[model samples]
Target: MARSIKNPKKAKRKNKESKKKGEASSSSSSVPSMPAKVWQPGVDKLEEDEELQCDPSAYNSLHAFHIGWPCLSFDIVRDQLGLIRTEFPHTVYCVAGTQAENASWNYIGMYKLSKISGKRRELVPNKSNGNESEADSDGSSSDEDEDAQDDAQPPVLQLRKVSHQGCVNRIRSMPQSPHICASWADTGHVQVWDFSSHLNALAEMDAEVNTGATNSFSMDPIIKFGGHKDEGFAIDWSPLVPGRLLSGDCKNSIHLWEPLSSGTWKVDATPFLGHKLSVEDLQWSPTEADVFASCSADGTIAIWDTRLQRTPAASIEAHKADVNVISWNRLASCMIASGSDDGTFSIHDLRLLKGDSRVAHFEYHKQPITSVEWSPHETSTLAVSSADNQLTIWDLSLERDEEEEAEFRARLKEQANAPEDLPPQLLFVHQGQKDLKELHWHAQIPGMLLSTAADGFNVLMPSNIENTLPSENP
Candidate 1:
């Protein structure tokens, strides 16, 4: 949302009253009260009297659900709606693998969430006749609100689960065929499975059907490969080449999977060995069919081309600590984003990789970054989740505007106070989740994001940022 001040005079008055009271208390007590400031996770330790506060107005819509066990990885399945959808009241399909306490209790869950709707609240209160008006009572409505009514029914979730052999380390959906997905097992095996049956079952369960009752399905992986020497987390499907796949392991081996006419995959026996450490993540180029990228524990990013020999076409020292994840921008093909174990993430322009390619860098997250993804709709936007229990959205195009900052502080100093060191590019910070592991932008819904944490999952769209999604109108 465009920067604006909320309320200045009222906040100043309240602050003055509190300061007076604090001064009176200091005369008798030795302990001094901590001044009010925007709480920064990880950087600021919580006191016994402190508790996290959530602002309901910051989100247009939010929902949280659990499927019994924690899932370390998940993928959003593409729907019939073509990519670049900006419509509201959306429906989504997703598949996730569980990290259960008992390996036998682990399952692969397929989900269908429908009637996902909520009204977008205005970030700035409407001013009329020198009085502030609430967003909900302003009596102004738009088409977006028509689709997302204020009293819209809560989103419905229908789930279908299938038993898996071991804990799934990572999972990815095929870009061309969302129902056909692959998973990396902690048991040192990569398996491909067709979940079309589970999809069909979920699709048949409409609103009238009872979704609270869990349904279990029996199935086996369509194909399994146990060539990797150890368990790994890196896996991705090529967007340019349908059914083409890549998998890397803890033992520093990467395999190329080529689709065959027989419906199975032909993985290269001779692996691509470039990294000196475990491959942590992999991403196929959005524009190139033969080219892909990988990040490793060795703190390097390797660009590999299957057409060439098993060596990396180019390798860059991306981070000081282990490079944990990477995302190739689909709209901006030349730009790539990466997150690292040192709690920092950076954006690099591939065209200048040989020179000074890092265009932007952020050290906001105070813990190891868990996931990073560029928005499918906004070229300059991206989302990141960290072990610090925070998911932050950023817009790289923004820079510090001293004039705007001054106006905001002058008018809304007490309403929405922020640390002076807060980055201007930081759009929103979402918390409340414990041990966030992975997140994905819904391919079919503009601005919608689904994240999986140790507790469960959260589906949300921030009110301040999501309204900026590209529209046909100006």
Candidate 2:
């Protein structure tokens, strides 16, 4: 059962007071108030008179904003935050492509989302159960400071848009050079652009006083290739090799992009043709430059090496339906996550492919999954968005604890009525968005995730999920 946010401030305060009272009273003296019941999204239905209620305790920080035109795809532009940011009052840079009413109205946008203020809520022990066990708690007094920041000034969304020829199907920024981005357009052309000038413009505007305005400009792509017989959605830049690229088309052909010293890319004429159907998504290996992975509409995933062009090194029958998306785990090279058209997502262990490659599978989303991404900082963490209008975060390291659940049920009998089917690995489920298309975790910010949909975009960070990113402590 998906719930919406009502008055987060009020809910936060109320939950805080209740927690204090519960903490004061002994477990035997008085029974603590039960929490809001949890329910599955597609399985549970709200009645006509039943309205959705927001649980403020569920989130640490949440904000929503829109661009004039909805974006079909976007990629976060890396900044100088040193890649493991844990602080707040955060700022983000990204590039997005619009799906406008007319082909000519479409644009590739560069954005600077600033003043996203909030701290990571601290988790306290749950004293209600009399057992010394840790559980998620409501926000502390520091929330008041965050609320003040919100009231004084809301988060800002600033952008500079460049006119494009057609609707963009997908867009990806080079990890090595974020200002350089590759976009696949519906016009059956793949184009690369240098947004250095636009990034500089946004940076300059940041030094000025506040003004609500969007800057627009016209620019041509640095490189344009129309070699694909049909449009495609799959495109990715090699992480290990700067400027190296792979683009796959609906005609089951994938082309390689090799950067030249002259600031242009040389496209190989002989395309890789291992997949028998449309290539839906592509991901380059995080560890090996020549190694990559691709998923297809034929329900198969192929592992390929650029050195051996024509055939895949290994192939697996990954899903029963079209594999729409795949995310290669950078922190754990052996693990890859894939989402399918049949509303299921699975984790594959490449080393175990000869036996049973799939280590984990989920059927949580009832609609087709549009996006799947592994958390850059956490090896066992992942975020997924689906056509069902929901974004979910999962922690693969978690598993069902029957003893803990029994203790929880004994303490809060009514509220602990979560269905037995609820996957323990699922950490959070975010709703209220319409037709959620894609979600990406900020590599700089530990727990924050940005999602795009038909209505607009949402930036959210859940309070309960712990930061399990490997320590950088000296």
Best candidate, TM-score: 2
Model 2, position 305: C-alpha lDDT score? 85
All candidates' TM-scores? 0.86, 0.87
- For lDDT, the strongest prediction is 1
lDDT of 2 at 221: 92
* The 10-residue segment with the lowest total lDDT in model 2: 5-14
User: Model 2, 1-474: lDDT tens per residue?
Assistant: 222211111111112323443242112224455454454566666654333444444566778887768888999999985766666678888898989999988888887888887655433323444543333222234346445544645677777889888899999999999999999999999999999998888777753244434655888899999999999999999998899999999999999999999999999989999999999999999888999999999999999988875899999899999999999998888999999999999999999878789999999899999999988777788899999877888888876777765654564543324455657777777887788888899987878899999998888887655554553311
lDDT per residue as tens, model 1, 1-474? 344322110111112333443232111234543444456665666665554444444556778888778999999998885665545567788999999888888889988888777664443444655454343243345334534544587788888899887899999999899899999999999999999988887877875443753555678888999999999999999998889999999999999999999999999999999999999999999888899999999998999888999999999889999999999999888888999999999998899977877888899888999999998878888999999888988888777788887766654343445567767888788888899999998866677889999999999887666544443211
Taken over the whole model, the C-alpha lDDT of each candidate is 0.80, 0.79
State the weakest 10-residue window (summed lDDT) of model 1.
Answer: 5-14
Off by over 4 Å in 2: 1-39, 122-152, 207-215, 409-417, 468-474
> Runs in model 1 with CA error above 4 Å?
1-37, 81-87, 120-152, 213-215, 467-474
